[model samples]
Target: MALLVDELMTKQPRPLGRSLILCASALSVALVTGCTSDSGGPSASASSPGQQQKSPSNGSDLTDEKLGKQVEKTLDTAEVSDSDPLFVEAGLERVGDGFHSVPDLTRGHSYKLSVVCVGKGKISLSIAVKNPVRQTLDCDGVTFRQHLTSSAAAIKIDGDGMPGATGMVGWRLDKADK
Candidate 1:
């Protein structure tokens, strides 16, 4: 039977100073050893910090003119009507050879893309678009949400993850009839 630490420590007949020291030493060891390693599965992405830090690019670094043309194409393909404007920063951004580029708007603006009233105000804009990536919380739980932009009663959603899940969502105002 090894010495029962608790019994020995508490059954002290020593001076006040030594008893206090022994108690503190025990507590410190317990606290330090409390942390345990996790056995969860692997992480989502294994890309190193270097790759992650690399600025998002559209592949080919387009020149000013090429960038303009690419951005113009997005609006042309998108539901940007006369009533709504895709206000360009630096007039517009360039598209990468790869079909992607850094996001333009910083969120918090009134500008919109009409998708209902075609020709200039279409209601079939970007509602219900999926999110680019799914959002996740540290197990506490997170509400799924999609990116949304509104024009009048219409809304344009863009991105690419599942809707109504524990991730990002996407949806439009739904005014194709109007």
Candidate 2:
């Protein structure tokens, strides 16, 4: 009976020991994760007196980056004159987006321009599609949606509030696939 009692006591400790070790490990991990996580906690450096907190991502892009890339890929970057043999300046047209007016795209010729993402929050990109291909333009992101048509009256490209950057917006030309 004494031996039997001793055997049971030994077996009880095996499970209890394992449980205690597991509990300790879990507690350690919980403490570490809570301390090291990036949940807007002030860094040790920034927590110092007279130091300010830094922002996470600049929040530069949302939807316009993807759309602007698509536009740039479809257009060409070369400049052509109204009488240039490779392509002709069919005309310029305005693209409208609610309250903002986009740059003028030339038809009868493909033009390529660049795009940029503004700082954090709102997305922005600019393109300079030139006539006679003569200018490197800084433009605004909201202006790309204003493509009226090549046949419209000579529309002007407005670079209002455009960041100083540039990108390839899109191209215009006939069905020749140039």
Candidate 3:
């Protein structure tokens, strides 16, 4: 049994510490945001590190300019500089299960995916590049931000497969400053 365990450990691709660190970081972020509940509503603490407190929008139309303003406010509150060029800034509206695919993304560049729900509904968001899954987030108040490292030609934003899921999901994709 010992030999078998050692062989299995040797066959692993990534160092175990990397996975542990990732899990720890995710847990810390979750704790900081106070999003430990599964109920669909506003989070107890919506402000992330360096983020300002803002009232949750109540089913308002999320136009391009409005979404841009929200993204800018988030960036400003998070202390993220606006010197970096935006790769994609678009709004997505869907009534059922669907995905938005973004193609021709620059390799080795970091990207931020910000999602905001425009109406009253529950949403679960995920990201994928070809076959590999990258990140998944489900939060209340229908807002969350995820940082991703791009390595593929395209990426897909999935907002589906959740039971009774329906809403207008607004998204903003920005490239991080190198």
**For each candidate, what TM-score against the reference?**
0.21, 0.22, 0.44
Return the lDDT, model 3, position 156.
68
- Residue 42 lDDT in candidate 2: 39
Per-candidate local distance difference test? 0.31, 0.39, 0.58
Name the 10 consecutive residues with the lowest summed lDDT in model 2: 91-100
Regions of candidate 2 where Cα sits further than 4 Å from its true position: 10-20, 23-36, 39-54, 57-178
Q: Model 3 segments beyond 4 Å from truth?
A: 1-84, 95-97, 118-121, 130-139
lDDT of 3 at 92: 52
Q: Global lDDT for candidate 2?
A: 0.39
Reference-based TM-score, model 2: 0.22
Instruction: Identify the candidate with maximal lDDT.
Output: 3
**How are the candidates ranked when ordered by lDDT, highest leading?**
3, 2, 1
* lDDT (Cα, tens digit) per residue for candidate 1, span 1-178: 3578767777946688898998999998877655331222233233544334333243333333343343344334334443533432112211111111233343433333311111111111123223323322221112122334332332223322222212111112211221
Identify the superior model by lDDT, candidate 2 or candidate 3: 3
Q: Give RMSD (Å) of candidate 1 vs. truth.
A: 16.5
| Full candidate order by TM-score, most accurate first | 3, 2, 1
lDDT winner between candidates 1 and 3: 3
